[model samples]
Target: METEDDVPLHLKSLAAFLIRHHSDQLRSITLSPDPKLHYPLYIDFAELMNEDPPLAHLVFSHPIDYLRFFDDAALWAHKIVFDKLKFEKAVEKIFIHVRINISGSPLECPETFPSIGHVRVKHHGILLTLKGTVIRSGATKMYEGERTYMCRKCKHMFPVYPELETRNSIVLPPSCPSQRSKPCEGTNFHYVENTIICHDYQEIKIQESTQVLGVGVIPRSTLVILKDDLVDIVKAGDDVIVTGILTAKWSPDLRDVRCDLDPVLIANHVRRTNELKSDIDLPDDVIMQFKQFWLEFKDTPLKGRNAVLRGICPQVFGLFTVKLAVALTLIGGVQHVDASGTKVRGESHLLLVGDPGTGKSQFLKFAAKLSNRSVITTGLGSTSAGLTVTAVKDGGEWMLEAGALVLADGGLCCIDEFDSMREHDRATIHEAMEQQTISVAKAGLVTTLSTKTVVFGATNPKGHYDPDQSLSVNTTLSGPLLSRFDIVLVLLDTKNPEWDAVVSSHILAEGEPGKEKDEHLAHIWPLAMLRRYIHFVKGYFRPVLTKEAEKVISSYYQLQRRSATQNAARTTVRMLESLIRLAQAHARLMFRNEVTRLDAITAILCIESSMTTSAIVDSVGNALHSNFTENPDQEYAKQERLILEKLKSFEEFPDIISME
Candidate 1:
């Protein structure tokens, strides 16, 4: 039977053209000794087909046959270069990876490509493209290309190179070729050890990207196989465009009727899609709406910023400061990387600790929906491994599987019920929160995975809010963990009849049809436009603090330090950094190039609200007082003087003082 290694007659001409015109490119690839340095030779399929009329007709009419022929041609071209170079030791290392770019083709268009839900058996053996997010990636392992089997009865050795179409099928040779006393059936053949040629292999699971899925529809995923140079190219949560051939294999266990078999993509090329690319092109109508909004609020930046805060979670009533903080968390500060390769993360982390019915969960869900890429999980259902990374057995070898935090890299990770998470699981996020990376040292795999994700956690306080309890104690979180958050807003279910009536009216108005036409509500940008505006800010805006802003922030920090009590939840340098981040975010909201003093003052006010509510202060009727008294040295000195005066008076008039 003909095999894949046999080059077809029609492909020989293509092979000749590749050797004649692309010899230098092949030579350079062969000279690179490192496998990691290997780069695929990109070829334009349209251009190649235009050069060869016969090949063009065959490729369009019979794609599968043309693909096989193209593979053979690539192999032949590589062999010719190997012979010409005279690099005998490197001949086997020189692999020709042909990546065909199918531009402007209907089959290769992202919109026309079949989703995992629409894929069927008819798609097998055809070239296609897929767009999705990688949910899981298996460890790279060696895949056997050619195997040698030895018969036990006659000790006869036979070589077999499995075809790509039937690579996963379970089949053994019918009979052995040894001329023994009786022909031995090769039923008891054993694989010869150390006689197999292997290639690099990895498997990844891809789920449909969120933008491609319909509303309220759960995403579907499919397995993809990547070999050789393509292994280890992508990680979980990466949005990718994959171009490859679809192939199906028999089930590992034939008795399993529920899942008999499934198709897998053998990826020929993979490209990472820009996560923020969709934000650049806002719809014309939405842009016009935003322009009108700008016109209304252009005179007052503060009014425009408050409008954005109100638009974040319009359904929830009366937490304007908390909503503003959340908005800043979404539009993060500028990340700084110095010459020494040290990186300072600019993404802000927020924690919302509230009463049972204070809309914490609703706000979290709203934030998750607004972000372009986000993952939502509850602490009760989450594990340490599930939040970070876990080692799992695949094909008798351990593989590293990405968790929620890892998968949410470069996005937001919303962990609801933060107080409900186990102690160990809660501790697992410390490194990720501070360093912005996760380090895995399990199953002999030692690698650091980037988790540049903004963590937005929400939890209910323990029982009721007590004046004596600090924020950390109320939330059941340690001081070290609590200090990592840039802002910790405490939401109380305060009862005010006037405020309650307003909230009730807003809730009722939401169900009414004409409420949106109100003049007051007209200035608020549509939810879609608001989300795209945030994305645009994050992509383009990186605000720096001016001298005035820096001075204001410094003064506020010093004042807080002087007033802070020993039991204050967050009084460290992290708070100072948080102030800077908030100020930068505020500037970004106004589309300003630099943070002004007004921005710093706005940030300070938000921080003070969070600190005062979360901490326990002893001052009488002073809401802004930190949990500690100011000027402790002066108070102690005054007490000492009063004690001295009393002692002197007691000594001078002992008889009259009634010493008893």
Candidate 2:
């Protein structure tokens, strides 16, 4: 008889029954006196719990064995207590996540195992226990009230319930009502109509409650990748479930796991799982609002706000970076907002530039799971017109299928193998990036679609971006496309041994000791909330620049552009405009209705710094320096005329000129 006081509230109900059932087995157990017993036993227990049948049965075979195991377990118990205290202390020092990972094979299977068991981890010797189960191999993805197929050949169907036998599928309704909402249909039978179709060798169907069992043949496509199989497998259209610690800085959106799977993993998962044959439904308002935000930034002050925004999100590059930077500049400096009651748009871009194992593809997988908005990753190699802009078709009036960009509007669009992208196909993005809209003119279906998205692109630099080729000429990207981005961040796996250690340690910490905690994506979330806040402010406030702010901006740009060439100077002007917008945005962040001198000065410093960097680079930088130093503008024109005149004179008097 277990006393109520001896049991925790959560475990009290089951303790009495469990003790009664295991009394015979419990009586055979004993504790060993060996000092080293706990450490080895703890390892053994962890291994056992990780397996299916488990090693707990060994404890019940004899008293000596039980005693030995208990002694070992004691040391582990103490370690857990010590580790918990250390974890608490660390948490107070900083709010960052700590992680660890350990590895071991499944526990040995034991005969006559109990229905339930406990798994515990002890750090520095204090034990923390958790209840878990070793999932049986034959288990299927099935749930109550779901429908089972009687036979694919005969098209037989039946409801899933306690009475149904030989169940092999996990019940996955179209959506979870508790988390989302259940589809409202006439009968429980209707719930399974749109449920995922699995193709396996054998089929099971309900004949009549207790008599329900296997039927005939199954579909060839029935072997959709299971959740457990996701680590190594990637098939198109399959819905995959993955869980991992979120890392916000590595990708535009937060990534769910540390695994190195690519965006194709999710793409394949969706392709295999969903049979809808149509595009996922996306709200139009979200699309419109994203475009509006992009356009609004054109007039917003940018200088300091751009720096602040980029400082906040360092991973993205190009048009994606520019758009967000512009948006943030407007919101923080100008106190601007979009038509939708949201702060400047909260979006991200991903630039994957390297060979395999560079985390280009894996980054996409992580972002998909971490973002609040939908994640759509497409292949530059396999993607078609239907993958980007709206494509036209038959008598259905060329219904628009929201491609990755369309769906990812107001969110993220990750593109893999970006260098492999077809030139014509890549051109589709030019309009989208600059105009914030995708214009389609294919199959007589000319229409404009919203592609206001943060494009995360991955590509391998040609021959590792030839260091000898000069920074401006060697870039694999075309000048026009490169120019679209506000910043171009370079990622390299340096030869630093310390970097390797840090990366390895970071991955390892995810699963060990007192490191297991929910990975917080607060950085990304705060930006989102800020966007909403900006929207509120814009709806209520209209900010303007003061004379001092305007004059300071004017004088700053005049001084900065003195050395820049004609075209390069134009960029400076644009930079100044961006700075002004940013200053206005900072004023907004400070809860002001007008740009202040402080905001203008802050914006100016950041803008001037970026201008300096851009102006010093090869192509734009040379052009900028030439405008002032070499007088190349007039000198080059005269030099070209002189060359032409000399060539003509030489052609007319070749004999006399040679004699002289």
Candidate 3:
């Protein structure tokens, strides 16, 4: 037991502060039946700062030392509630966690939390908060924290602790002190195993999210060590904000080796940032802005929707249909578990089969930018192992490393030149796309990793695209995989002088966007606000299909099934699911929690545009030059009336949809 004078002044003060503020919580932990179990006391850093400013400073600067005091303070506080003898029964069981949160809070600034690349040698031994995606996690191991030793010369008892300055090694005392005034030389000591203190330890590497990095800049990663309750709490692909002491670990020693020191974080707290809203905090003002924007165009809902659509990829001249598809794909539908306990994925996949120089890669890049967390890779560069999880031998230990899709678990994945991937590799993602999970059984590792990600793929057609041929023949993609996409838009670069002239004028006028008063450019949201808006709707809205919406969607499915032009593989049950998801996503885009008939009609129109097998509305045409009509509301009304009549003639289905 450490005496009052044996503890450091700063640590003692911190302990006192905890006892003052969190006595009730500590009492509960002490009263628990299991003495060997370690309990976590989550201490919010901001609250600590408010309660005790200097103590907060001490914790921020000397976390490794102050955190130990916190644990010890917890012990004394618990002892106050319980007996000293009982509290001392298991010293290792009493621990308080310093759960620092800087993600969406005021403490998230660069001074409190810095990017991985900004960590320098000066930051070593300092408590720092860093945010990144977990790329790899090591096996849990038992770490020896404290051990008792008896001096061989003077029979003096002492404790040896792991040294943080040199990879947590223990140094032997050169001499033994006798309080009676005699000092004896004790170069050797006997190890006492009975007084050992140990805890669970794990190592994980976190890479700074590429979404925050500049173009072409490689991401930086730091090794993190988790102890006690922190082990296994986070896995690969999870975004986490870790607060810990920055230290360096020496590389393995070898002949003629320089013995490099790698930066490592001894984590005091780790908070996962997997929640959609937490990824991008939508401010009240921004939500108000969205509401006001929509309110201004309420009479013309399609106009308001077009305003939002124009915000996407505004730098590009115009591909209104493609832009709308991108927006819906990002703000995906709601995921629900069916009656059979099977999950129906809400993630909407978009495939762009276009001609070369149709800005296919541009859309891919733009979509990646729109997403808060995204991974962009070309099909040729990605293998099955690279797109999914893989087990690799790292530092003589097998560990699971996340791939592109896994790393972008909660967001989007853009694969350009998607056709260049091997068929085997393409086949591997079939389960990941539909089941929303990747089943791994490789290298003696068997585990399922969540891949709840939207796949935005772009690939050029196989030579010249033929409308008469099936999608499989044109894009060389399997029908099963093609069916997974909610929207498959074809962007053909037809040489029309009039259309080309308009596109050319738009492109030439791009540099002077600020000077133009064009309505399309009037309500374009900036990248930051757009990201917040997308995440806002995705996190908050879970639109359910109205009765009318259900009937319309069901009728469309039956129509597609009965249409002579139906492709058997493409018009299956999955297409119905896709229609529902698309309708729900459209409802979200309209800022509504109910999927109305209008939302259903818009979804059907998007589906109709991609009907490569049927000639529902002009068969198929180049979507690259598709621009918003002059009066979109009237156009929508006309299309809605025609579709309703079409549905009615098939089976006398009454139209319940209203334009108002």
Best by TM-score: 3
* Candidate 3 residue-wise lDDT, 69-131, digit = tens: 777776665655555436444233455554555444446678768899899988877678898
Which residue ranges in model 3 land beyond 4 Å of their true spot? Answer: 1-11, 47-55, 83-112, 152-155, 164-169, 177-188, 253-258, 276-279, 513-522, 564-566, 619-621, 651-660
Cα displacement (Å) at residue 225, model 2: 34
Runs in model 1 deviating more than 4 A are 1-9, 12-39, 43-64, 72-94, 101-104, 108-112, 144-161, 164-198, 209-220, 250-259, 274-298, 338-341, 514-522, 613-660
lDDT of 2: 0.37
lDDT of candidates 1 onward, in order: 0.73, 0.37, 0.82
TM-score of each predicted structure versus truth:
0.76, 0.36, 0.92
lDDT-superior candidate, 1 or 2: 1
Return the lDDT, model 3, position 546.
92
lDDT tens readout by residue for model 2, 330-403: 34333235587644322223344444455556555444432323434455544556456544342233434445
Lowest lDDT 10-residue stretch of candidate 2: 202-211
TM-score of 3: 0.92
Give per-residue CA lDDT, model 1, range 221-319, as digits (tens). 888888877898888768777878787755444354564456788887787765545434677786566567668766665566666666777777657
Best by lDDT: 3
Q: List the residue pairs that clash in candidate 3.
A: none
List the pairs of residues colliding in candidate 1: 565-628
The 10 consecutive residues of candidate 1 with the worst lDDT sum are 619-628
